[model samples]
Target chain A: MRNSFYTAGFSEVMHEVKQDPREASYIYTTTACNSPHRGLSAAIGPALFGTVKSVRALGVQLADSTGGDPDGPSPMDLALTGIASCGVTTLLGGGSARELIFDGIEMLIEYGAPDGEPGQAVRCRLSVDGVTDEPLMNELVEQMQTYSPNMATMIRPVPISFDCLVGTDESTRRQLTVEAEPITDRRPAACRVRWVSGTQLVSYPNGRRMLRVDQPKQLTGVDWGPNPQEYLLMGLAADVADQLGRVAYRLTGERHLWEVSTSACEDMRGLLLKERDVVFLQGVTCRVVVPETLRAETGVEKILTAALAQSEVRDLVSRSNPGGVSLVLGREG
Target chain B: MELNGRTAIGFEEGRSSSAKWFDDLTRVRFAGPVSAHHRLLPRELSPETLAVHAGTYEDPVTGCVGTPVFQTSTFLLDDASYSAFADGAMRDVPIYTRYGNPSQWAVQEKLAALEGSRSAIVTSSGMSATASTIFALTNAGSHIISAYDVYGGTYNLLREDMPSTGREVSFVDPNDLAAVRAAVRPETQLLFFETLTNPLLKAPPIGALAEIAREANALLVVDNTFLTPVNMRPIAHGADIVVHSATKYLAGHSDLTAGAVVGRRKFLDRIWAQTLRFGGTLEPLSCFLLERGMKTLALRVERQNANATEIARFLATHDRVAAVHHPEVGGPHYADLARDDYRGFGGVVSFEVRGGDDAALAFMGRLKIPYVATSLGGVESLVSMPSNTSHSSLTSGQRASIGIRPGLVRFSVGIENVRDLIDDLNDALNGE
Candidate 1:
C-alpha cells in the first residue's frame, strides 16, 4: 500500500511498531519454483514471454531492452506500476479510520540517470484526489516511504534537506573522530565495541586508550561524545592525511611543514528524528598547502593514489553498501 | 498653519484645505509609522525585511514550510512531455538536473526576486556563472570591455580562455569613465565591471556605465558579489544583468560554494540553455545550504558591515598597519559614489601590513579567533593574503598594477562582536 505523510493512516502506521509474534529467523526464506519446459530463455525487449504453465496466468514478464517492445510494458514500468498499486491498496485499506477516500491516486513516476550516476533514481509526482491538509500530507509521505514494508528495502527514495550549521562542538567532535584512525590494522587492527543504553564503549586490542560514544546534546542524555557520522568521517580524513603525508614525504625525501584542509558534504534532512537512506558524504575537497617550491609538484596525484590504496577508512567511505545493520536495545552501561 | 484668504483654495470644489493633507499623503511615502498595510508593497518594506521574507514560497507537493530539494539527476517525462520539451515548448517540470531542477529553481526564484530580475540561475562556482554569461552573450569576434582590477578568475578567463574561443576582451581602468567610454568600440557587445572592485574596493558608477552601454548598444553586466543585493540591486540601476559568487555573503556560511546569474528572462533563458551544455549545474545539497544561508543574509550582512567599518577605522589609525583599503577611506569621490549607490559598505577590509608578505602571514597565524583560510563571508572571521590566494594567478607585475601589494591582507570581517574582533586583531598584530 502507498503510504503518504498526509494520509490519515501514515502517522498511525509509522509510529505503531509493535513487535509481532513472528519468527526471528536470521535466514530469510529461500526457495525456487519448478520450471523445466518454461524457462525465461528468450527475452523480447523489456517483456519476457515464457512457455505454457511457466507460472500459470502470470507467465509473461517483460525485461528492459533498447528497442524491443513497441507496445509491451518494460520491467521498470511494471515495477513502478507495482509500487503505485501497492500504495493505492494501502491507502484504500486505511481509508476508513484515516478519513481518506480511494477514488484514485494519480502518480507520474520518472526514472533515469542522465549523468550516469549510480542507481536507477525515481521521482514520483503524486497527486491525491482529496487532501486539503498539506503539512500532514508531506509528513505522511515521508513516513510512508520510511516505514512501509513494501519500501523496507527500496533504499528510501525520499529526498532530504540538510542545514550546514555545524557549531564548535560538532567541529571538535569531527576533529576527534579523524584522530581515532590510527588504531586500524596491525596490532590494534580488530577493535571491539559494546553498546550501553545511550552510550557505547569501544576498546582496542593493544592500545592503551578506551573510547566512549554518547548521544548528541539535543537528545535527552548526558551528551558525553560525538555521534556515529562524526567518528566515521573523522577516521576517514585522518587515514587519508596519514597516508598522504607518508607518500608525499617518501617521494620527496624532504619534509617541509604542510597543511591539509578538507570539507565533507552531506545531507542531514532525512534524519529529522527518523531514518531514511541518505548519502553520508556527497563529496570531499582536500586543499593541501605545501611550500612554494613543491606546491605545484606532480607528486600530489601519486600521493592521493597511494593514500586511497592504503587506507581501510577510504575503503569504507567509498563503499555504498555497509555490510549490515542490527539493533539490540536496553544494554548495561 | 496659515492659509491665503484671497485664494480659492479651501472652499472650492475638489480643492478643499482638508484635502491638502492628501498631497502630503501622495508625496510623503513611507514617512510615518509603519502598519500592516505599509508592508503589503515592496517599497514599504526595508532591505533587511526583504532579505528576511521576500522570495519565500510554499511547496505545492508537501506544503513544506521551506523549499524542497529535488535530488534526482533526471525527471520522468512521458513521450508527449519529452517531445513537447524537445520541440522548444518549455514546461515547468524539471527534465534533467543539468538542464534545470526544482532545487535550482527554488534558489533562482529567491535570487531573481532579490536582484530585481525576472529570473536567475545558480552555478557550481562564480567562475562558471561568469564564463557562462560571457559565452552565452558573446561569440567569436565579439568585443567586451571590463576593469583590469576584476576578480583574478575572471581576468584569467578573459586573458587565457576567451582567446582560444575567439572572443576579444579589453581590460581598462573602470574608475576612469572617459577611458571606459573610449574603449567601448562599435564592435563591443558587453561592458562588464565589478559593482565594487575586489581588494581595492573601487566603486564603479553603475548608472554611468548603463548610459554608456545604452549609447553603444551594449549590455552592462555587474558582479555584485561584494555589495550584495542588500546594499545595491544593480538591475534597479539599469544594468542588464547581475552576477555573484554566492559562496560569499549570499551563502553566508563558508561551508558551501555556489554562484549566480540574475537578469531578464530573455537573457537568462539563453544562459540556461548554455548552462545545460556547460554542465555547471549545482546539485541539490549545496543549493539547499545556500537557500538556508540566505535566510539570515540581511542579519549577517548588517553585522559584518558594522564590524568591518569599525575595524577599518581602527586599522587606519594603527601604527602597525601601513594602509587601509575600505570604501570609507578610498578617497572622497569613491566614498561619495559608494554612499550614493549602496546602502552599506561591504564586510571586506583590505590593508597592508607594516612589513610585507611575511608579516602578513605571521599576523594571520597569530590571530586566535579568525581562521587563516582562503574563503570569506562566513559567520567566523577569515584572513587571507590575496597575493597567495585569490590573486595568485596574476603575475607580480599584474597584481601590483591593480594595487594588490604583497603586504595586502583581505580581512573578511565576520558577525562577531566588534570589541572581541578588535582585541583579537590587537593581540595578533602587537603580540599583546
Candidate 2:
C-alpha cells in the first residue's frame, strides 16, 4: 500500500527516464508572484514586489498597516509554505534511494509570531509513510534540511538585490486583450481572429484580404501565410528578440526595436504523422542585429546568448512532446 | 556532475520563456465576464448576463483573461505529491486530461449556474453524459422509468442498451402523469425525460414527476438540451440531476459536441467517477467551444424560442399541415402539461404533412432554406423527417405508437427572419 505512490504517477516517467537521462529532470518555474505584499506591509504602502526572474516583484500592502485587519498569507507564511514544500520535495527526492514508497506525507510547522525581528526558533512535525528504520530516516531528514534549495536559502542567507521596473523614468506598462470569433466548423479549423491593436484575421473566403492557410509546398494550401512550422521558428526568434530588446534597452538606453529577422527549414517527412510520431523542424537558426555601437560593446554576445537562453518558447519546443498527439478529421453536420 | 544525463539547473542563469497571443490560450474566447465565479448571487443577474459571466475567472499564472486549456497527461509529481495522491489527498492539479481540465471546469461552473445546481461535470458527448449518469445511478438489475417520447439517442440507450446491461426500463407516455407514477418499481433508480420532449415538443410536468420520483424514492434527471436554462431550470422544479447536450442550444453552433450533468455535489461526483472510467470527458478545445457558445445561450435560445413560437403558430393553421406538435399549438392538453416549465415552446416543432411519407419527403425536398439533417439545435434552421431520421431504426408499428407518423417532419427553427422562414415553409407546404 505504501509503495503505490511510486506507481501512482511515475510508471511512464520511470520508463522514460531510464531511456533518456534528460527525462529524469525537468525545469519548472512559476510565472510571477506578489509574495512580499503581506498584510501589514501591503496595507499602508506598496510592498516589495517581484517577477519570476530579474524583476523584483513589489505589491502594495492592501490592508491596514497596523496589522489590524486580516488579509491573505503573509510573507513569513509564504516562506514557511515554501520551506514546507521544499522539505517535502527534498524528502521525496532524497528518499528515492532507500526503496521508500511514500503513500502520504504531512507536515506541521510552527514559528514564533513577529514583534520586530521575531524569534529564529522553528519547530517541525513530519509524518510520512514507508520509513521503518529510525536511524536511516533521521539521516534522510537531515540531508533534506541541509540540501533543500529553499531550506539552504534559510540556512545560508543569500543577498537579494532589488531591480524595480518602475524605478526607470521610461517605465511603461500595457495589458493587451484579443478576441476571436468562435470556430463554426472545427474540421477545417476556421475562426475569426482579432487583437486589441485592431489586427483582424479578416481572411475569410471571398472576403477582402481573405487568406488561405499555407502548409509545406507539397501540402495543398493557398500559400497566403507561412506554415505552422515556420511560425514556430518565428515565435522562438521573436521571443529571443524580445528578451534581447529588453536587455538592449537597459544597455544603450534605446527603446526602439528596429528589426529582428529569423529563418528556419524543416523536413516534415517524419512528422506527416501518426498519433505518437511527428517531427516538424530539423534545424533552426536565429540572427540578431543591432546598432554598430551596441554591437561592439563588451560582452554583447554573452548578453544576447543569455537573452536567447531566457526564451522559454525555444526551450519548450526544443524538447520532445511526452504526451504525443492525436488528430481527428470529420465532416460538417 | 549530471544526476542522469540532463543539464543541471545551475544553467538556469539562461534558459527558455513562455508567452501567449491574445485569446489563443486554448481555442476559448475570453469573452466571459471577468469574475463571474466570485459573485455571491449569479442568479440575481439575468440569464443573458449569467450565461456570459458565470464560472469565468482570470488565470493567476499567465494572467490569461480567459481559462486556458491545461493539455497534458500525467502531471509529473515528486514523492510527497505521489504519496499524497496515492494515499488519497488529491489536490487541484490535474493528473490527466481524461479525468478533467481547467477548460472543462470553467464550462462546468457555468452549467451549474445555468442549471441552478451545486455541481456539474462535462462529458465528451450527450450520450456519454446519459450513459455515465444512468450507469452511475443504477447498478446491475436496477430499474429505470422513462417517458415514451425522448430523443432517439436516449431511447436507444434506455429501451435497448440498458436491457443488455441488466437494467429493466419502462417507457410511458410523457404526458400521462398517472402512468409515469404507476410504472415505478421498488428498485427504480431514476425518472428520465427531456425538459421538452424531442420532435413532439411537449413539456412533461417536471414538478409532478419530481413528486413521483420522491414517492418512489428515485432520482429525477431532466435532459435540458432543448430548453436551455435560458428557459426554465429543472432543478428548481425538484430535479435531482439536469443533463444537457451542450452540443445543441448551449453550444448554439454545431461546431462542438459536449455534454453536462449538473446537480447535487454528491450525485455529480458519482457521475464524474463514471465519466473518468468511461473516459468520456470533454477535451479542452471542445470545452472552449462550449464555453464560447454558452456565452450566447440565453440570447440564442431567446431568438430561437421567439422564432419557433411564430413558426409553430403558422404551421398549425396551414392547410397542407394536418397537425402541428408544439407545446402551445399541439393541443390544450399539451399546453396544460407544458405550463409547469414552458418559458417558450422551444425551437423544435413536429408536424404531419397532408399526404403522408411522400408528402413529407416532398416538403423536405422543396425546402429551400432549412438543411435536411438528422440533428437539431443549430444557428441555421434544420428539417428532418422522423420516419427517416430519429425513428428510422424503429418499425412502423413502434414509430406510430410513439406518435411518429409517416408524414411527421421535425423543424428546428433558426434565428432567421420570421417572414422568410414562414414564406419558405409555405412554398414547401403548397408545392406538390
Candidate 3:
C-alpha cells in the first residue's frame, strides 16, 4: 500500500464529490484489522459541518447547526454540541475495541431556546443502524452517554469573556482603546477596555474616560480543559491532525501546511417547524485549509477525505444510530 | 387616673409639708444586690445572655469576663495527699488534661445545659463522635441498624469497616418502619440515622425510629448535623444519642471542625471511655472556637434556614429543575415527619436537573456564587453532584436504586443574601 500510494495522482484517482445539504444520508461499515490497517476508514459528507459522530463501529450521529457565529455558545447550545460529539466519539472507540459492528445508529438532541428568539430554536439529532444484540446496543448507548464530550461541557460551563483594543501602532504614543462587551457576540477576538481615574486624555466605548495608566495588558487566556466540550474538540482536532499527518506524509514526500477546524451544530428545526422532539444535524463541517499544491499532488480532492478516512468522529457520525431521550419536569406549580 | 396598686395618704399631702419632719426622718438604703438573687429571677434573661453569662465564674486573678483557653497538660495538686486522690480515694480531682480540664468542662457543661442533655462528650470531628458512639454502643459480632442513605463516610464505616471488625450493619430505609423492624436481629445493639440524610435531605421520622429502637432494646443515635438543635433537637424527639458534625452549621464560619455526642450520662460515660481509650478528644483551641461558634448558632441557623427555604422555592419553580426532593415539599409523610421532628426546614435541599447528568453538570458550572464542592452546612452556598463526587464509588445501578440520579444536585444553602442565591440559581437554570 505504501508503494502504491506514491503513484496515486489527485485527478487520476478520484474526482471531488459535491455534498447536498437537503438530503440526509449516512454510511455504515465494520472492519477488523490485525494491529495495523492501510486504508483511512470513514467519510462525513460536507452537508453536516457541525454534526457530531457518536460511537465508532456502530456509528451514531448527533445533529447540531449553530455554525456561523464566532461568539460564545448560546445557552445550552455548546453543551448540546459537546455531548453529541463526546457520546459519538466514546461509543465509536468503545464499540470498535469490543468489535461491536453496527448496521445503523442515530441520536436526537433537543433543548429549550432562549425566550423570544426568532427562527428555529436549537435542537440536535443523529441516527444509526445495522447492529445486532439489544444488550450491546443499550450498552453502547449508555457508554456514549456516559462519555459524551459535549455532554460533559454542557454540564460544566466555563466563564469566558474577551476584551478588544482598537488602535494603530506608533513609536512614541499608540492610542489604545478598550471595549468591555458581552461574551455572546460571535467574534473571533475581542478586547477589554477600562478607564483610569484622574485622566481625561482617552475615553472607552462604555463612556468611562480612559487615561494613561500603565503599559497595555494582554487578555488572559481561558482555562478550557475543565470543560468537557472544549476538551473533546481538542481531542478530536489533535487525533485528526495526527492521523492526517501520517497519511499525508505517506502520500506526499514532505509535511505541508495543514489546518483542521471542526464545528458542531444542533438542529433547531423543531422550534421553527413548531414540532415536538424533531431534530437532526444541520451538518458536521471541517474546513481543512491545506495547501492547494498538496491537494493537487496527493489526489486529495477534499481536505476532509483523509480526515474522514482516519477520524473516529467521522466513523461515528456516518452511522446515524437511534437513541432515547428522557425528560423530567419540576413538581412545584 | 389612679395607680390601682399604690397606697396614698389623702388630705395630709398639702398639710404635712414640714421642714422639721423631713429633717428628723432618717433614710435607710439596702445593701448592693446579691448574685444569688439574680439567679432566682424566673426566665427574665434571654438565651443569648445566658449562653455567655449563665454558669460563668469570673477569673479569680484577672477578673476576665471571657473564659480563658486553658492549654496546660496537667494541673497542680493542692495538697500533699493529692497522690491519694490519684489513687482513687478522692472523687473530684483533675490530675491531667487528658482525663478532663476545667475549660473543657465549662464548654461541655454549657452545651449540656443548652441542649438539655444529661451529659455531653466533645470529640475531634463529627466522624469521631459517631464512631465513638457506635463503638461504645456495639461490640464484636453485634448487629447495627442504620439508614440506607447516610453520610458516605459513615456508610462506609458501617458497611465495610464495621464488618471487618466482626460487626454487621443492616441498612434500612428509616422511612419504612416495617423494613427497619424486619432488619433488626437478636444481636442488634444500636440504630443510627441522620436527622436529615446528607445530600439526600430526607428527614427521617426520629420519634418513630426512636420508638422502634426503644422497643427493640437498642440505642438510637441521630446525627443532627443538618438540623441543628436550634431547628431540630433529636433528643427531644426521643433519640437516645445526638451527634453533630460541628463543621456544618455549628461552626457557621467554616473555620473549625469539631463533634459532640449529647446523651444520658450512662451512654456518654461509655463514649468517654472509648474516647479515652482511642484518644479522639477535641483540642482545647477547637473546643474554644466551637464554644464561640455556639454563641451565634441560633442566629446563623435562623438565617440559613430561611435562605434555604427560599432557594428551594426558587428551584421548585425552575423549568430546568425536574424535581425538588426537599422533605418540606415531598410526600405527606415527610412533611408530617419534618413538622414533628424539626422546628424549621433545614438548609440543605437536593434537586434533579432536567437533562440528567449533562444538565446537572452544566448548571453546576454556570453557578457564579455558590461553589461547586462537597460537604455542606457552611456560611457560603455549595453545590455537588453525588453521583460523580461523593458517592462515585458506588456502582451506577446501586446509585440509581438509592434514588441518586445522574442529574441530582445537593445544595447547602449558606448565609448569603437569599436574593443573591436565588438570582444566581435563576441565571444558571435559565441559561442566561
Candidate 4:
C-alpha cells in the first residue's frame, strides 16, 4: 500500500495540498553576516557567514579568495556543493516517484573553474549500483536536470539588481543603480555533486566551517548569526576589499591597509506586498576608507574605481549568468 | 525482491563500509498505518458498516476477507523498500512489525474510520497511547492541564512520573470551564481530559474545553474510551487528538490489551515515533485479536448502552441506593451537554450504598450475575469499588475532595438480558 514517496503521511499532505495548492507553497529564508572578527592577513580578507533556516538552522560560511578559512568554504565551493547535493536529492526523489530502485549513486560534477569562465560546459557523471538498465538511469538523470532547484537556478540566469551607496570619505556619499541584463541564450555551467539519503549528508567535503543563519528575534531567531541580507552585504564588502587589495598591489610594490563598511536599506512593506512591483531592499551602501599613507599615491582614484569595477561579487549582484546541466553514468562498487 | 521479511540482500553483509550508506537499511521508519482499506468507506457510512468493513484487508491472492496475521519481525527489502528507507518513509512498506504490520494497519484503519479521523495508531496498551501522545506533543519545559479524576494510570503518569521529566501538570476539575481557562499558562501545550470520567462518569463540556484549548493554542486530547466512537466521536467536537483504552470496549470481549490514538496524520506521525521509542508496539497476534474483536463494536455498545440505562433507573429508585450516577440518570454536572452531545450515554453506572464501604462490600459479595473485578466493558457485567480499586493510591482527604465517597460502587453493564440483571440486583439489595 505504500511506495517510496507516496507514504501514508505524505498521502495526507497530498490530500490537503489537493484541497488547497497554497498549502504546498513555502517561502524559504536564509540570513547571514560577516565573521565578527577578521583574521590577520597582509592583504584584504573577509569571511562571510550565514544561517540557512528551514526546519532547523544550518550555518553556512563563504570564504573569499584572499580571506579563505580552513573550515569555511568559498562562495563557489558552497554553490557547487549545493548544486551537487540538490542534484542527488532531486534524482532520488524523482526516481522514487517513478518506482525505480537504486542501491547507491555516486555523482561527479566537473566544471571549468570556480568563476563562471566562458565556453566551459558543466558536466555530470553518475555511477550507479544495483541497476543495470542504462535507459532508466538516463531517464532519472534527465528528471534530475528538470527537478533540481539549484540545477535549474544555474541553468537559467537569475534576475539580479543592485542599488549602491558609495563614499570615498566618511562625510561624502553617492547612490548608484546597476541592473544586469538577462541572458537570452544560455550555456550550461559545469555541475557539482554530492551523495545524500534522508536528512543526513552522506558524503561531503571534510572539515568545513559552517555558516549559521537565522531569523530576527521577532521571528523567533536566536540572533546567533546574521540574516540573509546581512550575508549579502558581508560578501559584497569582502569582495570589494579583496579587489581593492589586488588593485593596490598591482599599482604599488606592497599591500595597503583599507577598511570597507557595507549596509542596505530594507523595506518591510515590500516583503509584505504582492510579488510583483515589490522590492525587498531599496539599495546597498559600501563605504571605502583609503589609508592616509596611500591617499597621496598618484593612481589612488583609478585604483578605487577599478576595485569596485573588478569585484566578482559586485558583478554577480549586477548581472545574470544562466548555467546548464549534463549527465553520465558508471558502475557502482 | 522477496515479499517475505528479511534484511536487504546485498547490503546485509557490509559492516566495514561507510555506516552512513548502510544506516537507512538498519533503521526502521514508523510511517503510521498504510492500508488500502483506509478512507475506502465513505464519510456517510454508518458505524455498523464501518466496524465490519472499513479496515478489513483483502488478500489479492486468496481473496481472503480477513487480514492475514503477518506474524514476523521484519520484512524483505527490495529497491522500492530501500527507496522507502532512504527517503525516511518506510510506512506501509512493512520493514519491521514494530514499525508497522498489515495487522496493525488493518486495525488502525478501522479505528480511524470509526473515529472519523485522518489516521490512527495502535499501541501495546492504553497508557502507551496516552504517554506517547503527551510526550510527543509537549516539550521538556511545557505545561499540561488534565482532569484530577482521570484514569489512575494517566493521573499517576502526570502526577508521579511527568514532573521528574520537567513537565508540570495542573489537575483541574474538567467541569469548571473557568478554572480550566485560568489554569492555562504560556507554556501549556496540551489539555488532557476524558470524555466521560472514570468511576464518576462526569461529562466534561468537550466543545467548550476545545474552545479554551484553541484560545490557549494548546492541543485538546480526549480519552474517548468510555463512550468509544459508538456513543461519541470526540474529533467531531473539536478534539485535536483522541486516545482510547481499546482493551475495553473497542476490543469488547476483553481478549487483548491494546490502545489507539486517532487524530490528524501530522500529530499521529509524531506520536507513532514516540511509541516506537517507548517500545509500545502491539505484536501481530494481539493486533489480529483486537481487529477481529472490533468488528462487532457497534452491536456490542448498542446493547450495553440500553442495559446500563435501565440499571441506572432501577438504582435511582432503590431505597438502599443512596445515589446513582449515570448520564442518562442526570447525575453528571453537565447532563444537558451529555444529552445533546452523545448518541448513547455509554455502559457504566456508579452508585453509593446507604451504609458506606462495609455495606457496599456485602452487597457486591451478594451479587450473583456480575463478577467482582477491576476492569470493565466486557460481555459479562463487572463491578468494583473505587475506594479499594482505582482510587486506593489517593489519600482519604484527596479522595474526599474529588467526591470519591466511601460507598461508591462502579458498575460496568454487559449485554445480558436486562430482566435477569435487574432480578440479581434486587436480590443483592435485599441482603439474601
Give all TM-scores, in the order shown.
0.51, 0.53, 0.49, 0.61
Which ranges in model 4 have alpha carbons more than 4 Å from their true place?
Answer: A1-333, B1-32, B37-39
TM-score, B chain alone, candidates in order: 0.87, 0.87, 0.84, 0.92
> What is candidate 1's lDDT per residue for B281-390, written digit by digit as tens?
89988988888888788889889889999999999988889989888766643644747668787899999988899998999989998998977778889999999988
Tens-digit per-residue lDDT, B1-432, candidate 4: 345422222222211122211111222222235544333576468899999988777776687778888899987767656655654455546778888888888889889989988688999999999999988776555688999989999999999878887689999999998899999985677899999999888999999999999877678999999999999998999999999999999998868899999997667877887899999999999988998888989999999999999999999999999999887778447545647688897789999988999999999999999999988888889999999999999999999888888889999999999999999998998897
Writing each residue's lDDT as its tens digit, candidate 4 over A118-206 gives 64334456676666777877776765665454454445443333222222453444433333332223322232233333212232333
**Candidate 3: deviation at residue B41, Å?**
12
User: Tens digits of per-residue lDDT for model 2 on A78-144?
Assistant: 3333344445544653454244555455444433313212232234555665456666667667655
In candidate 1 the C-alpha lDDT for residue B357 amounts to 97
Q: How many clashes in candidate 3?
A: 75
| Of 1 and 3, the candidate ranking higher by lDDT | 1
The C-alpha lDDT values of all candidates are 0.55, 0.55, 0.51, 0.65
- Expressed as tens digits, the lDDT of each residue in B1-432 for candidate 3 is 321211111111211112121111111111111111111112234445545543332355587776578677776665322422321111123446655554555556555555556457788888888888887766554678997778888898898788776578888877788999899775566889988776777778888898888776677899988888777667877888898888887776778877888876545755765776778777777767777777777777788888888888788888888888776566543655646546676688889999999889998899999989887777888899999987888899988877898799999888889998899999998886
Over the stretch A126-192, how does candidate 3's per-residue lDDT look in tens digits? 3444455566656655545433433322333221111111122122222212122222222111111
Candidate ranking under lDDT, highest first, comes to 4, 2, 1, 3
Model 2 chain B poorest ten-residue lDDT run? B19-28
**Segments of candidate 2 deviating more than 4 angstroms:** A1-333, B1-41, B73-84, B87-91, B330-332, B338-340
Predicted candidate 2 versus true structure: per-residue lDDT over B179-296, tens digit per residue: 9988987557678988888777777888888988887767889998888888889899988899988888888888888888888654665577678889897888888888888888
Off by over 4 Å in 1: A1-333, B1-45, B332-338
Instruction: Specify the highest-DockQ model's number.
Output: 4
